[model samples]
Structures are given as structure tokens and as C-alpha cells.
Target: MKSGMPAPDGIQPARRATIREVADAAGVSRSTASRALTGRGYVAPPVRDRVREIARGLGYVPDATARHLRQQASQSIGVLVSDLSNPFYAGLAAGISQQARKRQYTMMLADDGGSPEVEVEAAEAFVALRVAGVIVTPVSAEVSTYLARQQIPVVEVDRQFSVGVCDAVVVDNENAARRVIHQLLDLGHRRIALVIDEMHWTTGRDRLAGYRGAFAAAGVPLDDSLVVTAGWDVDAARIEAHKLLSRAEPPTAIFAANNVLAEAVWRAAAELNMPIPERLSLVSFDDVSWMSLVRPGVTAVAQDPVALGEAAISQLFERIQSPHAPVRTVLLSATVAARGSTAPPPA
Candidate 1:
């Protein structure tokens, strides 16, 4: 029976053993028993064994609630992402879940639906849950300040966080973008255009830097008019492409920053009666499942979201185990997959 509760008439008078009971049975101080059970601080190996055996014999499961109350931390982890509908993010979430499962940890997943307010709300929810750690691919840099003030371990995935404020795992967006541009330049296309989302995010910004770097290296002057910014949606990109193509001088090659933008660019080219790899060349940042099935296979920079996700989860757990350790940054590599969509520009 509990300290102040009476056993019901039909219930047996079995009682849950407290930590003090385990300590008494093991012939050790309560503090020593706690150290032994938590594997924290210092406890002799023999004494730890005795405490474990006593705990087992007494059928005593250490009260996680009580431990959390004392430590002020929950063992749960929180994952916040921009869009669940994107295949890349979905794959990343799966990998994170798999890694967490292997480590005997649980995850709480939230999607911001590409909204800044939603992202803040998700972070606040994680704080309310008292999660041990947080993994996020933020919508913007504003989230850094919002989350950092919470005094929790946070790992930023696929994006850069504020300097010296949080750990991060990201791909080499600049190198990947440069590779795509070099591929187009190799195909004898001089007037190449780049379709991208906002440059506020690290991914977009680095990709733009890469694009400019490649052009500079190739002795091609940067063309501000050729770089078009659009939302991360096929329809939005298609509308933007229409405006670009209807201009007096259109591009001979287009490098779309992501899968959705690539699809829209392709659709616009088809509508304008522009033959891919003949009248125009096309390449994109990410390779989606349906990339190969399109009329002209999309040449793309492909990064393994699964591996990125797994690495992020691994890093987060490492931080959990050693909270005061040095901040680590992991950069995943990407490969340019050549396809039928790129060729020498029309003479």
C-alpha cells in the first residue's frame, strides 16, 4: 500500500518498494544506491552489483518519474521538421526513428508545414514535454534565438544554426551546387539560369554561392537576371519559369535548386515547345523517386537523406550522453547523377 492510501477491499496489500528499501536491502546508503542504479558519479563495481541484484529481487523498477523530477529532464526526444509531405524529409524521419529505436529512446515528431509560427509552436511544445534533447531543421534563423533560450540540447539538421549556439549536421550545399553548374557548363551551355527558393535559409544561400563560384571559375560573368527565386512548389516554379521564358532572351540551361522546382521547370519547357538537352538543358539539386520516370531523366545532385537523418540522431544521442562535450558539425557528401536531361546547348 502507498504511504497515505488505503488498500481496497478486494485488492491485495502488495506495496511498491522505494529506493530506500532497495538501499536497505543492498546494505548501502540511499545516495550510493542511486549512483549505482543511475551509473552516475562514483560507486564501487561490487556495490553497484549488489544494488542491482537487490533491486531485481525486490521487483523494484527505478521510478523514472522521480528521477526525472530530481534531474528535471525527461528521457524523450523531440524532432521538428519543415514539411512531412516532402519525400526527403519523410525518409529522414524514418532514419531518425530507426536510430532512436536502436538506442531504446522514443521520439516526438512535429511538422511546421513551412510556417515560422508553426516552427516556434513546435519548439514550445517540446519544451513543455521536457524532452531530453531536440532535433530540428528550422524554417529560418529566428528559431535559433527562440530555442537557445530554453536551455536544452538542440541539434540542427540539414541547416546551419547560430554560431557557437548549437550543433549541426548539413550537406555541402555550395559544393553540390557548384557541381551541378559545372555539369551544365560542360554541356556547352553559357546562358544558364538557376531557379531557387529564398536565400534566407543556409541551403539556398550556400547553393547560390556555389553557383556563382562555378561561373567565376569558368570565366563566365554572373547574370543576376537569370537567377529566379520562387517558393518550394512546382506550380510556383512553373509560374516563375513562364515569366523568364517569355522574356526576349531566355536561358539555354536551367538548374533547379530542388525536386519540386525541377519538375515545374520541366513542365514549363514542355509547354514552351523547348526540347530538353537539345534546345535547353536541365539539372536539379535533389533526386526524387519519379526523377527517372520523367521523359528526360533529370540530372541531379543526390544526397542520402537516410544517412543524414541517421547521423543527426546519432549526434543528438552523443550530446545527451555528454552534455558538456564540444559542439560537432557533420557535413554529408553529395554526388551528381548524370542523366539524359543535360547536353550541349543548341548552336
Candidate 2:
């Protein structure tokens, strides 16, 4: 076949054109052709134009895999979250995607459905892909340790496990929880119940600590019966809430540690025909859309989950750029958005 012409019938189709073919057609060295095409190094304008024209004519496509290998970095990042169905995680993923697009990086997302085993599997897959870095809402320390051992840059978001071993971006869960619980305490809520999901992760652990701290500051002995570990789902929380409300000495106020638990508390109150604040006071550690739209808006710690995602991406890029730098933990602040849900205990 003639140079730059389609293969003749009965002959096997020719392989895709490479830089060598472009260089040959342009009568230039491979390095010069590369410099011209990538606009990286020095090449005369006439030579660059000739090389580009030849590349176009020859259908030469640059190999991104080879280029990434040469640069020792991929153009993609991995993002792992506990649940994408939750608006909180969805917002976080959006923030990460926005920042990644701005930086000319692609994101590979993995949802582990709140399972620690699944989380570890996702981390292993990311490592196998040789992603530039990872941002994860970790379920277990094993995933973080595995990534760190592989010399991968990792940034823990929302929840952290590898403290002092990796970068982290999280809100001040304990302080925010303490502040909101203190608001309820100041309103004369003595028998307040704390509804929580998982206590193994920092998100739940810190919030629980803050709850205890608030009661301690007031010199009130904690009643173990008032603390409810309602699994991770709204249904589980609802059942636990029913049990709490059925008790003869039921709590007059409820502090839900997350949006899901908050929703369960609200539903349980509704089913029991309990009037909020008048019959039972309610507060939540995380706010959601329905919280504000409801008749009596829930009192909650309003955290910027989107901002948290952005911050996690920023930290991951920093870690990728400076792998040997000292590990850093960024703690953001959440504010209480008090509405009509919380009030003094009923007489």
C-alpha cells in the first residue's frame, strides 16, 4: 500500500500508527516528533507543523498508558464511600468530582454499602488500577493500612481509621455534638436519650464522647439505659426508638447521632402521636433536606458534606504531590441550626 493509504483488500488491516511512523513521515527524530506533538520541549515551528500534519495523515494516536507510565502517575483518582444513596455521600462525591475535573483528573467511584469487607476489596481494586490516589470514607483500619503499605496516597474523609498514618479531612464531631447536646441540656432536658448507629468509627465515637461530655459538665450521672445502639438502618433505629418510648421512665428528649437515626426518631414519634418539643424534644447531629421542610424543623448540627469532599480531594492531591510530607489531619467545624424541635422538658 502507498504511504498513508488504506490497506488493500485481502491483506490484513495495518496496526494503528505510532510516533515512529509520524517521525518517519515527517523526516524528524522520535524525540523531536514527541516534543512537537506534546508541546513540551523545544521544536521549530516549521518542524512542529510538519510533524502534526504527518501525525494526522498517518492516524497516529498517542498512547496514554505509556505516557502515564513514563510520568509515573495516572490521570485518574479513586473515590470510595459508605453509601451513595445517602444525600450526604452523594454531595461529597459531587464535590470531589468537581475538583478532580478542574485538575484534569478522572474519578473512579466505589460504593461499599457500609461493609468493612467490601471496603477492603474496593481499596485493593484501586491499588490494582494504580490510581494516582484515593479518597475514602473508611469502614475499617485494615483498608487504610493496606493502602499505606502499598505506598499509595490516601485521604480519609468523614470517618478516619489510620490516624497518624494518613491524611484525613473530617469535621469536629465531638465538639459539634457536645455543643448541640449542651443546647438541649441548657433547656432543662435531664433524661435525654442518645440514638446512635456504629460506634466503631470516629464519626460515631466522637459524637458519643461529646454527648457524654455534655452530661458530665452538668454533673448528671449517665443512665446506661438511655443510650441506644440502633444498628445502621432507619428500620433498626425505629424499632429501638419504639422500645425507648415504651419504657415507663422514657426519656423526655432524644439526640440522634446522624440523619438516618434522626429520621427514625421522627417516625417513631409520629407513630406514637407525640407532639414534638411539647411532648418530646428532638435534636440531630446531622441535618438533611426533610429536616427543614417538616412542620417542626429538627434542631441539628449542620455540616458541609460537600465541602468535606472537596477538602478530602485537596488533601489527597497534596499527599500525592508530597508523599514524604508529615501526615496532616484537617478538622472542620459544624454549626447548630436550631429550629422548633428542641425545647424544655414537658412539666
Candidate 3:
């Protein structure tokens, strides 16, 4: 064949070269070529070099999927998150990807958009792909149970639904919420509104518990009407905020359970002409860029999402290495960023 030309045996340039071609060119058995290329069972240095040179010349590439199937384990790990658009999830995914690359493993990512059904589907897809393990911010316990039954190593991040069944990495949500709420109470805020999306998951449930705990600790009675379940939609949260602020006995302060609820509260306060920390105090569980950039920075409980992601991956690798080992749950602490948004309730 001419230089840079396709093989004369009808093999097109675009066609993937196979191990058989490499073996034939190297004048070796397929097993010998595979051992040399994969660094498996030993082959003579000279013979290995010769085989590699022939593979390079023929543009031969081994199929990782095929190799993984034969070995019954993949070098790829699956990561499933609720929402990629949220900065928290984005940062978490970046951390996971970085750690995965460092371990010479490929990452397969899936966005479930915060839907339990979608999360389950993604888990099934990961199984079909033969991923060596999974790291997920689970929406429901079903995903974890499914993966556990399949014998796939799983590490949960951000939230935990499968305690004792899989490893997990998360912030101390309940304590963080209690600390932020205590700050609001110390500012002489009597009537505080607790705004959250849902209590179905541990994140929201723990945060709500903290809010109530803070009130009880302060000898303050919580008004059931002040606790609003705004659901996951931002628009719904905004509407809920409007209703809360418009009440005859509107809260003097608002404790938003997450970043989304925080934004909704901010918007509602603006629409009602209630300037933050002036007419009404505000606090949030998660920190966002705008939280600090606004005229009066919003006080928040800042969780290290990236660190959480990295921890999840580290736990995943441990599970992969020792599948029968005891499951671990890592809890990272969240710090309170006391900004201008929180202060003594208006006189």
C-alpha cells in the first residue's frame, strides 16, 4: 500500500482496525498481542515493542467495552445528579470529574432534573452500560435500592436515602439550619417564616427539623401557617413567598431552606417593598454568587459542594476496591456567612 493509504485488502481508512489485524501484522497470536497491549500477563520487552509498533502503524485500537465485558468490570464510573443548572450540582460534578480523571477512570454523567422517575431510569441506564460504580445525589430510595440489588457500588452525595446500604457524603444540614435560624432569633426576630421546597428528601427534612429545633430552643412557638412547602419550581416558590409576605401577620424574617427558596424570598420581598434586613430579615441554607453581589449581601449557610463531590468519589473508589466493606457516611460541616441581609428585626 502507498504511504498514508488504506490497506489494499479493502480496509478503509475510516474503518476501525482490529486486534486480529495487529496480531497478523506482528506475526503473533491474538492472546500474545492482547497481553502486550494491555500490560497483562508478561510478554518479552522486544516482542511487546514490536507488537505496539505494528498496532501504531495499522492504527489499531482496542475496544474498552469488549475488554471490560470479558473482565466483568469497567473503568468507567457513572454520576447522576438532580440538576446541572444549579451551581451546587455543577460544582459537585466538576469535583467528581476531576477525581475520576486523576484515578484514570472515565465518568458517565446523567442529569435527572430532580425527578425520582428520571433518577431511576438513569440508574437503569448506568447498569446497562456496565459501569463499575455509581455516584448519585439520589431523589428517592428506589434508585439506591435498585443499584444495591444489582451489586453495583454506589456512593450518595448531597442527600442520603439509602442509609446502611450505600456510602454517602453530605453536609450537616440540620445543624447548619439551626445555626442560621439561631442567628435570626438572636437578632430579636419573633415571627420567622420557614420556606422550603419539599420534605421528601433528607436535605429538606433535616433543614425543617433544624428550623423547628431553633424555635423550640428559643422558647418560641412556631406557627404552622408560617411553614410553606413551595415545591421545587421557582415560580411556585415565588408565589408561596408572596402569600407569606401578604398575610395579615406576615413574618418578621424568612429562613429559606435552599438557594432556590432564598431567591424566591428575595424577589417576593422586593415586590412587596420589604427591603432585606430593613423591613424583613433573610437567611439561606445554600450560598450563591448573587447572594453576595446584591446591595445587601444575603447571610447563608455555605456548604462545600465541590468537596462533597470529591468525597463522594473517594468513597466510591473505596467501595469499588472493597465491595464487602462497611458502608460509610461522611458529614461535612457548613459555615454560616453572616452578611448584611440578616440583622435585628425592624423597630
Candidate 4:
């Protein structure tokens, strides 16, 4: 391996082909080769095809970072989500990737695990990478505030923390939740319970408002005790749900605010040997896969997460195009997928 010594097998790692090499081989200037390969400028058809063929044969790949540096702009966007392990987030990310690619913008995706420190770190990294804009389901207002200070356009997805200060794309949480409760009320469920993790975010707060609103619309008083604050994990939620179901005057129906909570409730019901709809009615806000795989499909408020992602990218692109435009909040709709999970209370 000494310098210029005979190689063991006369083999060597192939060097990456550069634009200059391609230009020299194609008998053209570097700028013309660039224009021909990227189709960014005028080039005659024959010359363009010949240059492209030579570039391909040489396995030449353009340097995106250098191109962005030359233009003083990036053709990339940053996407930050709370949790990617969740199917909802995964679907949303997939949709965003598809839409961003369609517009020729590369997406740089990150998961913050709902941590403020991690989110701040990601924000700093995005700025360092020279991303054109950011789309995030922020853990707090700080992410948007920091990006705004950096003069980077941002769009919040799924939930909002900065309100009018940032663009957002979210579903009609209140109306969708209210409609879910209405269905329960119409079915004569009086002592209904709501199992939720926290009321801190716009998602939880709005859904709670809708839950209470439904009772108000029905002229029924809400029992505050029934609003159980469960923890984020499944075991914690299951314990809370078990306690609620074990009450002497247990509710006839339970409304789980999300899929994880719904899973906890379902597991608790199974442990208690309660036949769903026959004794305890279950409704979930998220329509996940397992909800339908069960014997009795869970009644759910279905949000099109893929469409949600598409909407977020669209909003982010708009923000990037018009940084001075008025901030906007686009609210998409959800539908009630009434399955076999809900029924009139026993007797």
C-alpha cells in the first residue's frame, strides 16, 4: 500500500466524476454542461442530449450544496414532527415527502419526540443547513418564535402554539369532537367519560371544549370528575381508564381523545371483561388500523393525515413565497367513521 507500490489485486476505489470532467469529455464549457444537465438555461436539443448522455455514462452527479451556495438559496424545506413512531405522524411525513418532491423541493425531516430542547436544536440545525422554510408540529411557541427571528418562513401542522404569528394547518378539532359527543348524546349516553392526556395544547383544549359543548347543546350538565387526565404512556392511561371503569357509578360510554388513549381504554375494557357496545361504548378520535381489526370496529373521528401533510407543505410553500403575507390558519375537515363500537347504553 506504500505510495505507487504494486497493488495486491491492482484494484482502486473509483473517484466520483465531477462536472468539469463531464464538460471536458462532452467537448463543452462548464456552464453549458451545467445548463444542459440541469435544464436551467437555453441549450440546443442535440447538444443537451449529448452532454446528458456523456454525463450519465461518466456517472456524474451534481453537487446540490454547491448549486444552492451559488444561487444563495436552497431548494429544500425542513419538516419537524413530534413523534414519527406513531402511524399518524408517519403518514403525514410520507404525504409531505410526496408533495415536496412533486414541487422539486427536497424535504429534510426530523422527529423531536415532543421535547422542547430537541426541537430548538433541530431549528438551529435547519437554519445552518440553509433550508428555505420549515413545517413543524411544534412542542412549544419557542420553535416558531426562534424561526421568525431568523427570518425563516414557518408553518405549524396538526397543532398551533404561535397562533396568528405563524401559518398553521389543522383539522376542525372542536367541531369534529363536538360531533363525536353529539353522536354519543343522541344515543342516550348520559354519564360519558373523556380520557385524555393533557389539556395544554390546542388539540386537547379544543376537543375538551367540544365535549362540554355537546352536553351544553343537549341541556345536560357535564360531570367534571369524568374528565380523567391520563398520562402519555399506555400503562399510565390503562391504569387511569381502569379506575374510571371501576367506579361505582361508572360511565356507560368513554370518549378517548386519541388512538393511544383509545388503545388503553380498549385494553382496560378487555381486562374488565366488558363487552363493548353491550355494556361500555367506546369511541376514538383517531381511526388507526387495529380499531378495524377487532371484532367490533371502533367508532372514530377520522382525520386524513396524508391530506393534512399535503396541506402543511402547501401552506409552507405559500409562506416561503410571500413572507410578508398575512399569517393564515387552514382548517381541514374530519368525518365520523361510525362503526360497531358505539350503541345505546345497556337496558
Candidate 5:
């Protein structure tokens, strides 16, 4: 073995410098060295500075796991998001970071990738880490139970529930849907079809309810045949759109539950050679940066995902500070943008 190189695993000599070595070298107690390295407890400013300087000079890196154990806690929050690629969640992540930094906290991020079991696993992992709290966009009701069992304070973002387990910070999904549908109606689109995600999700269900309320107010019969529940993916929505357009009496306009599904509707229209607002009109639930880049520009309901994220972080901290505080359900409103996607239905 080379003299300066690290020895092979399991055959290495056992003379590696320990925490005691660092403390002795720094002329400080072991606890003081630990606190200085991890930036944990209160110590004299001069002693902390001196210990940290010496530890850095000695190329010391403390084991984070060991530090966590010794402290009996971690100064980090766990975040579980379903789809990391979704722009809405990405915006939310940015907001979480903004507020967490303000509170001197860090996040342990977990992207479940839309798997229920993986969501549970992530929650378990967060529990094992002894996080200060959790902010989760739950993929299933099952995750709620798991989080409840862990007894961790949680702030559920972008969805609402009455499970009595955790606080929720969500958008006014029903009102957002209603606003979009009303926009289509004002543009003279009576034959509007609603494309939505699977009803299992709270947002999907609430948006569907909002769609129904809009139709009721507009005096349009709620046609079950015109409503389609696609999986939370563009391809699924595209297939559903194809099937809906294949019908003899196709809708003159479409209302997609979200931006991704809205994109699918756009693609389906192109595939069928249906011109926008000439043969069909469209409206969607969420707006992102790319909304205006599309052909006619997509009309949508825009919500502040970043604000929602910040609210969730704040709510979690509130829960941690006052565990018995009333569990509040916060609903942020959405803005309805009137883009060029909708017009009077063709005669």
C-alpha cells in the first residue's frame, strides 16, 4: 500500500484520527469540538471559532448521522413531493427553500415519483432521521396514516383533507376550475368537455366538483359522457382526447384539469387537424412560463405554487411550536388568465 493513500476497506490500519484526537489537538473538550464542528449548541464565541478553525485545518468532517444521534434530533425538515418534474412542484420546492432558509432550517428532499409505496418509504426514512417536521404533498391517503403513526408535525401542500391528522395548505381548486369553465362559457362554448386526473387525488376531485358547480350555474346539464378521467400524464390525456373527439357529437371546447393535460388536448387537436376556436376552444387549470409560447396561447387558472410552499413551511413551524394549535386548512386563490385559446363556438 502507498504510504499516503487510504488503506483498502476492512484491511485498513485502525489509527485514523478520532473525535478525541480533534478535541485534544484543538485543546477543547470532546463536546465543545462536536458542537463547533456541527454548529449545534451554545458555546463561547471565541472557543467555538478556535475549535472550528482547528477542525477545518485538520481536514475533519463529522459524521452527520452520529451528530444527529447525539443531539437526539435534526435541524432539517423533510419534504415529500410526488412528481419532481412537474413545474408546479418545482415552484413549490423553490418556495419551501425560501421560507426554510429564513427560519434557519434545511430540507431533506424526497421525490416519490408518484409511487404510493415509495411515498410511505420516504416518510419512514424521514422519521428515522428525526426531522424537525415534514411538508408533504401526499400521493395517497395511506401516506397520511404513516405520517400520523410517526407523530411528526406535517403541512400538506396543494391538497386538502378532513382526515384530522395534519394541517393543509392548498389552492382554491374548485373555484379555479369554476373560473376556467366560466371563461369558456363566456366565450360561447356550451359544449365543453372536462378532462381530469384520476378522482383518487383530492385536487382532482375538488376540481371536478368545481366543474360541476360551474355547469350548474350556467344552466348546462352535467353530462357524464363528456367528462373523462385520465391518469396524471400527458399520454393518458391524449388517448382520452382522441376517444372523445372520435365521438359523433364531439365537444366544441375542452377544459383540462391541469397544464400537462392541457398540452395533451393541444396535441390531440393537432393530430385531428382541428383548428383552435374555429372547430374547438380550450382552457386549462394551471399556468407556467410556457403558456404563451403555444400556438394560440393557452387560457388557464394560475396559482402561486411558491407561495403555497412557503405557507406550508410556515404552517409546519407553527405546528412544531404549538403542537396543539388548531389545525387550519389554508386555501390560496387562483387567477384566471384570458389568453387567445377561447372564442365563440363555430356555428
Candidate 6:
């Protein structure tokens, strides 16, 4: 029975004060206490104030489970991401968490590692928990349809596989990619190799289109041989870069499609004794911390991942408010952080 001792095996732990206990302490009816705590119905001003103060003094919190059942609205939101190890996804989840907390909702987060099966499983868990809504960087459209069938609202961020079927918050990947390619081309680089993960996702597809668009606009024919399909790992991308750089007629410049590939190409160039912007010019579609910290900073297209997450959560709240409204897509902007990595092709 000592203060620091564990409770007896058969004894139950103390629970938070309930509304009934608060009502007894305040000399008010349970219904009156509920009205005062929720601000949902009228109570005499003085009595309401007195009840609220007593409730606070007793450290009382209403039962969210019971409340959710009565109102059909849960005070928690589910957030699913492709890869928590990636800074982009980490920043995005941080933004979503901040906004969800500010709005007085709990955030349940899950990492799917870019797997469709994992994404769907997380969706199912969210539904089981009765989360008010979900915000996801989805890998497939199946997750959206599954959640929709369960009467759950979803906001897809970064990229979309459910374009017209669900809400999405995304960047204009094409425009950003186009601008970077134009910058390289304007600097007199024609044989520029574009290294990408895959063209299946909207992000990669749009970015590649922009690369091609810039070449077409400048009347420069793109070299098909220079377009390298490097898978999603840093080492694989590095190998692809090494192969491309070792070609008999190597490209004068390389445009990496994302931060992972950017790092890969940067390492490859270093290993091959090619100085950036001297023997090989380099650019990336996404920016990372090392891009700015390296001796010769890498020029990159930067997207605010945090803002993207915040926007996605805001849109999700709006959707919850108007469930029957037409689904819409929000396009965010990205900017180029021009650094020392890009310049005219070597003489």
C-alpha cells in the first residue's frame, strides 16, 4: 500500500474522473454537466462556469468512444505514408501531425514502405478504429476505393492513383521538371541523361514529360539512349549512373528524377573522378539536405513537403464537412534552388 508500490494483482488502476463524478462534485445534474462541458445546450451562465471549473479541477475528460458512437464522428485522423525513412515523407507526416493536433484531433500514423498491400491493410485498420478521415501518400487506387466502400473520407498527397475518383494534393511535377531542364539546356547542354525510378507514377511520368517538353521547345532532339531507368534504390541508381557515364559518348549533363537518384548520381560522379559542372553537370527534381551542404551545392527543384501535408489535411477537413461535394485536386508549386551543380557543358 506504499505510495511507490505496485497495485495488488486483483486491484484495478484508478481511472480519470467521469461526467457523473464531475456532476456530483459540482452539485449539478449529469445532463447539465454534459451540456456545460460540450457547449451544446443552454445552461445558466453561473452554473455552467461553476461546473466547468470543477470538471477541470477534477481532471475530467469525456469518453471519446461514447461520444463518437453518438455523433458518428471520431476525433482522430489516420495518416499513411509510402516511406517514413525518406525526408519528404517525414516532413509531410510532421505537418499533418501539427495541424491535426491544432484541430484537437489525434493522428494515427502508418508507414507502408510504398507497398499496395500494406497501404490497404493500414486503411482497414483505420476503418476499424473509426477514424474521422485518412490522409495518405497512396501507392494505388485500390486503397481509396476500399476506404470509400467503408464510408471513409481520404485525401491523397504527393501523387495520385485515383485522379478523378478521390481528393488529392499534389505538385505540378511537369512544370518544375520543365523549368530545371530548360535551365540546363539554356546553359548549352544537349546530351543530358535523365535518370528515373519509374514512369508508372504520375510524378515520374509528369517529370519525364517536362524533360522532353524542354528539349522539344528548344528544338533539341532527345537521345533515347541517354534516358536511364534506374530502380528506386540509391545503389541501383548509382550503378545506372556509372554505366551511363562510362559510355563511349557519355552525356555532358545528368538530370536525376528524385532525391534518391540525385544522391546516386552525385556519388557515381565522385567515384569516377568527374567533377560536378566541369566534367559532368548535374540537377535533381527534388532537393535534400546534403544537396545544400556539399562543397559544390547541387542545383535542385525544391517542394515544400510540410506544406503539402498541411494542405492535404485542410482539404480532408473540408471534405469531411461536405462529404457529398465534388472531389477536387489541389496543385502546389515547387521552386528551383540553383546551386553550383549546374553550368554549361565542359569545353
Residue 25 C-alpha lDDT in model 2: 86
Q: What TM-score, to 2 decimals, does candidate 6 have? A: 0.93
Q: lDDT for every model?
A: 0.86, 0.91, 0.91, 0.93, 0.85, 0.92
Ranking by lDDT: 4, 6, 2, 3, 1, 5
Q: Enumerate residue pairs that collide in model 1.
A: none
Stretches of model 1 off by over 4 angstroms after superposition = 1-67
User: How many backbone clashes does every candidate have?
Assistant: 0, 0, 0, 0, 0, 0
TM-score of every prediction relative to native: 0.81, 0.90, 0.94, 0.94, 0.88, 0.93
lDDT of 3 by residue, 91-130 (tens): 9999999999999999999999988999999999999998
Q: How close is candidate 4 to the true structure, as a TM-score?
A: 0.94
Say which prediction, candidate 2 or candidate 3, comes out ahead on TM-score: 3
Winner on lDDT between 1 and 5 is 1
How many angstroms is residue 347 displaced in model 1 relative to the true structure, after the best TM-score fit?
1.4
Which candidate number maximizes lDDT? 4
lDDT per residue, candidate 1, 1-347, as tens digits? Answer: 46756547436426888899999988899999999988999999999999999998888888877878888878788999988888889888988999888877789999998887888888899888788888888876667567668777888998785646788999999999998898788777888998998786888999999999999999988789999998887787899997887788889899888878888988898899989878889998988877889878888999788888999988988988888899888889899888898888888
Clashes of 3: 0
lDDT of 6 by residue, 112-162 (tens): 988999999999999999999999988888999898889899998998888
Model 3 C-alpha lDDT versus the unseen true structure? 0.91
C-alpha RMSD in Å of predicted model 6 compared with the true structure: 2.5
Quality of model 2 by C-alpha lDDT: 0.91
Clash pairs detected, candidate 5: none
**Winner of 2 and 6 under TM-score:** 6
Candidate 1 lDDT: 0.86
Give candidate 4 regions above 4 Å deviation: 1-13, 43-47
Task: State candidate 1's TM-score.
Answer: 0.81
| Candidate 2 residue-wise lDDT, 36-139, digit = tens | 99999899999999999999987788987788889977999999998898888998999999999999999999999989899989999999889999999988
Clashing pairs for predicted structure model 4, backbone only: none
Q: After superposition, how far is residue 338 of candidate 1 from its true place, in Å?
A: 1.3
Cα deviation of 61 in candidate 3 (Å)?
A: 2.6
Report residue 37 deviation for candidate 1 (angstroms). 12
